[model samples]
Target: MKKIAAFLLSIGPGLFCIGYTVGTGSVTSMAKAGSQYGSQLLWVLALSCIFSWALMEAYGRYAVVTGRTAVNSFKTELKFGKVLAVVLIVGIVIGQWNSLSGIVGLSANALYEIARLFLPGLPAESYWAVLSIAVVILAILYFLLIVGKYSFFEKILILFVTIMGVSFLISMFIVLPPPGEIAMGFIPSIPEGEGGSLLVAAFVGTTMAAPTFVVRPLLMQGKGWAREHTSLQSRDALSSALLMFVISASIMVTAMGALYYKGLTINKVIDMVYTLEPVAGKFAVALFMTGALSAGLSSVFPILMVAPLLISDYKNGELDLKSKLFKRLTAVACVVGLSVPILGANPIAAQIATQVANVFVLPLVIGGIIYMVNRKAVMGEHRAGWLLNTGLVLAFIFSCVISVIGFTALKDFF
Candidate 1:
């Protein structure tokens, strides 16, 4: 019992890392993909999980041995120096903006659905914004008021993850997924329509993109003591990340496997959560809404941690996401996130767009990290092993090709 407890405890920063893996993008974009393309893009989801593991594992090791965040490590060892820094910062800002906006919008979509039933008297559009805001307020209060439990940050993240799992799994069973269609999910193929292909790429990108992946070491640093914790931290972080991947892919497969099979196409992000009874059944509605609500809340907590990290890095090259400026940034981002309804209430479209942007932004970030990390000076003896190097190179090439193909496929789409 003690051994098991200690093993789990060694993954001190596990929750925060998982927070990045499980976010609003996972819910909206993956749901859209399943609804639009059925399981045609299940391959992307599987591939994304693999790449996430590689990318995050690299990021974790770089931080542990060097005692630096991925950003700082890049700055220290990068050859192009100023030019690359500018590009990285730009990408980070845009990615962060789109991500936070999409998450807020995703959360709002769930609230909008819930209100339509529970408080039919209120306007869903505006009331959703208010509800989302209240959720942020409530979460912040919970984080602040919960004392020692939440100050750790990962504790709250763990709670969100637990609820998310229970909620989504229940939804899956409630929907009573068709076994044959679920089997077909593993058979990879591109869907026929242009929209189907686009959703596949967008879904892949969104499921993989989030703040915590890049900023993991900072959160981990606050939890564990030093360089000695490096390998264990990486292992723990990877496990947590995989847990999220399972939950995310499960929701997508279940939603797509069942709903899309019925010939009902999903047009908005909220449609998955709200269109349950109208299409599938009352149980479907309840299950999806429950999953969506949990997903929204789960995502919000990590963004709160991430906002401050971005601010601190900008102002002081530190990841002290606790300063007043960082806190204000987090709050403002939250407010902006909640206002996603203004971007067009077509829940699925907006969700997919942000996800597409993630696919677009990925090449830059991933390419930069691969170049920076493998440099002998940066990692010394701790550099990626030769086998790992070969694998990473292949993964990088594939990512670049798919990303380019995806962008070109949707050319002229602004």
Candidate 2:
């Protein structure tokens, strides 16, 4: 029991990040990629996960060494820091609400479908039913954040992640993707198809989101980690990010093995559930939905955390998680998260907007991190090494290129 307790206590910022990164957007993007192109797009997932780890490690390290959050560092150290901080706070608040709505909306779909198993007459086509389910979930989440202990919150997220990881792994094993084809995905090649390029770009953009870094410093500080914990923090970041890759790839591989060659395409996020039922059995379908719902619920907490944490950073105010103002702010954010779902946001449209649209803000965020990490006055002896700088530069350039690609895809969509 002691050992088990110790293990759970060790999970921190990295686990929270894993929770946020693998939400419905990832499930939709990865599963679609796998369904349409087999394991051919695994290379993109690999690269994006690697980039996420590198950038997250850098951000956490900065916070530990400098004892400053990203928004705090920006507000104090540079000329346009205040503007940058404001931009991040506003952008993430808006972006995260969109993401939250999508997540709850997606989860409600799975939950409603599950309900249909026991309640024979439940309406499968009711959007308002989905909205009501989402509202109830949102209210519960909001209440928990307002009243729950911070450690309790972290433990809940880790539990959800565990549920997601186990279910997805088991589902993947049931589907059993071809080993040779999976290996070929590592060699990196463009998938040729109608939506291949757009999917690839979306995969990269969503996986390496800017908010991941923006939220990192706050989580690290909240955990009371210091410079001495750098190695531990790096390990946490790498492990969580790699775990993200495994779960994401598993979704893809399952799609490839079960749906791809059968000539079925995933048109909606929940459609993967139906695809699995026909091939992997009802049990596999239930397990996959369990993981999908876990993924979606896990993200709600972090998505809510993003804006409040940033607002605190910008204001340099109290860090109490249970304060009245904190609760009010979180309440307002929850309302924002529910805005689209309550209005009957289409699942596909929500996925596109949340997963791919907000990525347009990545370049600036990446650039800000690059500038901050290299400044001697802020980092002092803990400045980023040349290797880290190289990675940042490459990440920045890659993000810019992908953002352009994503925008072009959007333009073509309209």
- Give the winner by TM-score: 2
Q: Deviation in angstroms for 335 in model 2?
A: 2.1
The residue pairs that clash in candidate 2, if any, are none
Question: Candidate 2 on 15-64: residue-level lDDT in tens?
Answer: 78887788878887887888888999898899889888879978988888
lDDT (C-alpha) at residue 361 in model 1: 53
Could you list the CA RMSD of all candidates, in the order they appear?
A: 3.6, 2.0
Q: Write the per-residue lDDT of candidate 1 for residues 1-414, one digit (tens) a residue.
A: 677445545664666655665676777766766666666666777777777777777767777776777666556556764565556666655665666666666666665666566666866457446455556644563456224243456555556666777777766665556667666767877777567656766765665563555676676566643568667766875686577667877777767656777776676654564556665666566666666766666666666555557545544455574456655666666566654555455545655666666665566567666775686886788788876566557667756776776686567355
- On lDDT, the candidate that comes out on top is 2
Whole-structure CA lDDT of model 2:
0.80
